[model samples]
Target: MTGAATGLGLGIAERFVADGCVEVHGLDITPTPDRVVPGLQHRTVDVGDAQEVDDCVEAILTAAGRIDILVCNAAIMQDRHEVLQTPDELVERVLRVNFGGVFNLCRAVGRAMKDAGSGRVVTVSSQVAETPWPGMAVYAASKAAVTTFTRAFALEMAPYGVYVNTILPGTMDTNQMRDSFAGLGRMTGADPESLIAAKRTSMPLGRMGTPQDAANLASWLASDQASFSIGGVFDLTGGELWSRS
Candidate 1:
């Protein structure tokens, strides 16, 4: 699992471990403290770096013998700016980490899965890919790329019994979400709590989603129960996608 050190990624990794996965390897840029999960092994890796990602995958294979499931959840949401104000470097950096990371890992792990003839790849995208909130052009675009690429890749990998799917999560009460909201508030000179409360009220479900909600869906997607699911995008948006009120 990429980005398994925090937020949704950590939730997913925890679920996998709790589900009795023999070995769960978490790859992240941050240093994960020892024994975050009983059998979870943490590797500090910049997913944006292709070489680093490749080496990490190789190491996981060496240690675990096989990678039955891969969860691509490493991403960043930064510089909430309009396109005119967004820097070229920022765009490149976001794309490199958010989309390139997925590309590198999928290529590396997908090759291994192809050789093995069976594997599951569950990518965590965001509802913004389709919903298109302002000030999120770059992040949304990267996720859009991931959504489309995963679908196409799934078709290619289907012949080899590998299933690939994407998950689009809506507003969740994660540290990242809180941080992003705080940052946006700072930019807009608005109270973060007020902004967050407004967001909560905007959700048709009457509450913001939890990391566990996303983790539950991810766990399901990674299981054999989702065997027939392929190249599909699952939304865990708490009906926010349809709410315009």
Candidate 2:
């Protein structure tokens, strides 16, 4: 699990570890995370770097013998801007973390899962990939790529008994979502607080989604009960746009 230091990733890590039967090795760039618990081990890792990811995977394999589940949730939102106004460097940085991280982790971990002939891989992408607003161009594009990549990777790994799936979450109440609201404020000159409040109340489900919503769905997808699902894209968007993915 990448980005497990905070927000949705943290929620998923907490959920998985709460079972007591599972030992979760949570990954994040954070050197130290406050969400300490009995069965969870927080690991410092930058998932975007291929060599770093490979090394980390190797270390985990050496210690754990094999990984049964991998959750790829590490991502950075692009600071809000129009496509023309977005910096090329910002685009590269976001792609490296958001898309490239998934690529690297899947390659390293997927290879191991293939050899083991059984495993689950889940990726957290955003709902904005299909329903794009103005300022989230880069972020949306990156997630779109993730959705596509995860499905294709699933196809490749399915023959080896590695099930890959994607979770597209809606507007969750988190720091990342708040940052997006602030970016929207900068883009459209509307008060971020007002926008945030409006968004929460305006969702079809009558409120913004929570990290738990995402965690429950992701956990379900990674379970043995989800054996029949392959290359699936499950939408947890609280009645936002329905994805064809």
Candidate 3:
């Protein structure tokens, strides 16, 4: 998994360990937690860099001898801003870290999976992919690309008995989400807590989703329980994306 140091990545990595993944590697741009699981390995890596991703994957394969499961969960999202006002550099950075990172990781690790003749790849997308949000055009677009990429790749991998799927998570209560809303507050001149409260009010479930909520699906998809599942975009966004009758 990429970006497994915190937020959804950390939660998913923890779940993977609990679900009996003997050896789980957590890779990210920053140092991972020292609170180590005996079977878990931590590596600092920038998934946006192709060389870094390749080296990391190679190192893991050398140590583990095989790659069986891959979760492309690395992404970055800036506060919602109008497209015209959005800087080219910021847009490029988001796209690079979000979409480009997934591309490089998938290319490097995907080859291993294909060579091994089977693997499960779960890409972390966003509820925004289907339920577009104003001012978050870039993030939604990138996740839309992720979903499309998963579909196309799933078809290709199906012949090799490999499966690729996407997990669409809603607004989750994580440090990342807090930071995101805080950024939005700065951008919009509103109190961060107020914006978050408004978001909670909008959710039919009356609360934001959790990392574990998404991790449950990730665990299922990564296991043999979902062997027959492929090319699916599983949403864990509560009822936020649904229209009320």
- Report, for all candidates in order, the number of backbone clashes: 0, 0, 0
Give the C-alpha miss distance for residue 181 in model 3, angstroms. 1.5
Model 3 bad stretches (over 4 Å) = 34-38
Q: How do the residues 1-245 of candidate 2 rate in per-residue lDDT, one tens digit apiece?
A: 78888889988888887644356988889887755766778889998889989998899899989998999999999898888888889999999999999999999999899899999999988888878888889999999999999999999999999999999888898889999999889888999999998887778878888879888998888889897998898988888766322
lDDT-superior candidate, 2 or 3: 2
The C-alpha local distance difference test score for the whole of candidate 1 amounts to 0.89
| Candidate 3 whole-model C-alpha lDDT, 0 to 1 | 0.86
Query: In candidate 1, what are the lDDT values of residues 24-74, reduced to their tens digit?
Result: 889999896323777778889999999999998998888778899999999
Q: What pairs collide in candidate 2?
A: none
Q: After superposition, how far is residue 87 of candidate 3 from its true place, in Å?
A: 1.0
Off by over 4 Å in 1: 33-35
Q: Against the hidden reference, what TM-scores do the models get? A: 0.96, 0.96, 0.94
C-alpha lDDT values of all predictions: 0.89, 0.88, 0.86
Query: In model 1, which range of ten residues has the least summed lDDT?
Result: 32-41
Ranking by TM-score: 1, 2, 3
